[model samples]
Target: MAEELQTATDKLEDEHYPAYTMGRAAEMLGTTPGFLRSLDEVKLLVPQRSRGGHRRYSRYQLRLATRVRALVDEGTGLEAACRIVILEDQLEEARRINAEHSSHQPER
Candidate 1:
């Protein structure tokens, strides 16, 4: 029982865990549910759905949403903002991969 509880707590701590409902996620980001739906409509951050078919978001996805929202607030179009965020995420992932590769390479 204790192990199960610990595992559940670990899941909550994971950034990829879909821990927040759409409404709660919007409230946390100070945005409206409509905005989150727009993000979803654009395929920016397609959240996982709950057992009942409600959208559930992870912390990682929420951060991406926040970035897109910031760009939109600064006058960028929704599609453009999503593209920028996608590129940023790609760059970060590439950098992470490069760093791992560099670390694994033997020095001359």
Candidate 2:
């Protein structure tokens, strides 16, 4: 029973990790595969490459793509939207790093 519980917990943890192929990501985001590839071409959202050179979109990338779509629908130009998304992501990452660093600092 303990082993079964551990397995279930592991599976849930894995699900929390980002991992997805371009096709699957497209289906989930209500976009086409070509659209994703175009995003890559325009430097909007680049996916990771597999051993075979196929594009693989992680959950993070998919969420960013969705944001891009939303911005576009809201009257933002594609290039501007992409730039905004990149900047926002960078800001979020910096915040996370800063928080982690502060948390690990030695007590005065």
Candidate 3:
């Protein structure tokens, strides 16, 4: 019983788990399914497809969609918003890697 509970908890915690349908993800992001489709079209946040061919969104993808929605709400074009969001994510990752590398360097 505890193991089953833990499995459920882990699924909730996993950002990469495809636990949300496209419609749910769109609703969570306060956007439309068409908007989510545009993100997939731009290859910015391609959601996984279920066995029945329905799109399944991970938490990570929803977050990306939220960011893009914010930009789009600010009057940015969809394609440009996707590009900005992708660049921002890449920049954040690069910064994290640089910080980790710097922290591990020996005093010089």
**Best candidate, TM-score-wise?**
1
Judged by whole-model lDDT over C-alpha atoms, candidate 1 comes out at: 0.96
Candidate 1 structure, TM-score to reference: 0.96
Q: So what's the TM-score on candidate 2? A: 0.72
Q: Across residues 4-104, which tens digit of lDDT does each residue of candidate 1 receive? A: 99999999899999999999999999999999999999998889988899999999999999999999999999999999999999999999999999999
What are the clashing pairs of model 3? none
Best by lDDT: 1
**Backbone atom clashes (below 3 Å) for every candidate:** 0, 0, 0
RMSD of each: 0.8, 4.0, 1.5
Please write out the lDDT profile of model 2 over residues 42-83, one tens digit for every residue.
897767788988888766778789998889889998888888
lDDT tens digits, residue span 1-108, model 3? 999999999999999999999889888888789988988888997788999999999988888888988988999998899989989999999999999999999998
TM for every model, in the order presented, reads 0.96, 0.72, 0.89
lDDT for 55 in candidate 2 is: 87
Off by over 4 Å in 2: 1-18, 51-53, 106-108
Q: Rank the candidates by lDDT, best first.
A: 1, 3, 2
Ranking by TM-score: 1, 3, 2
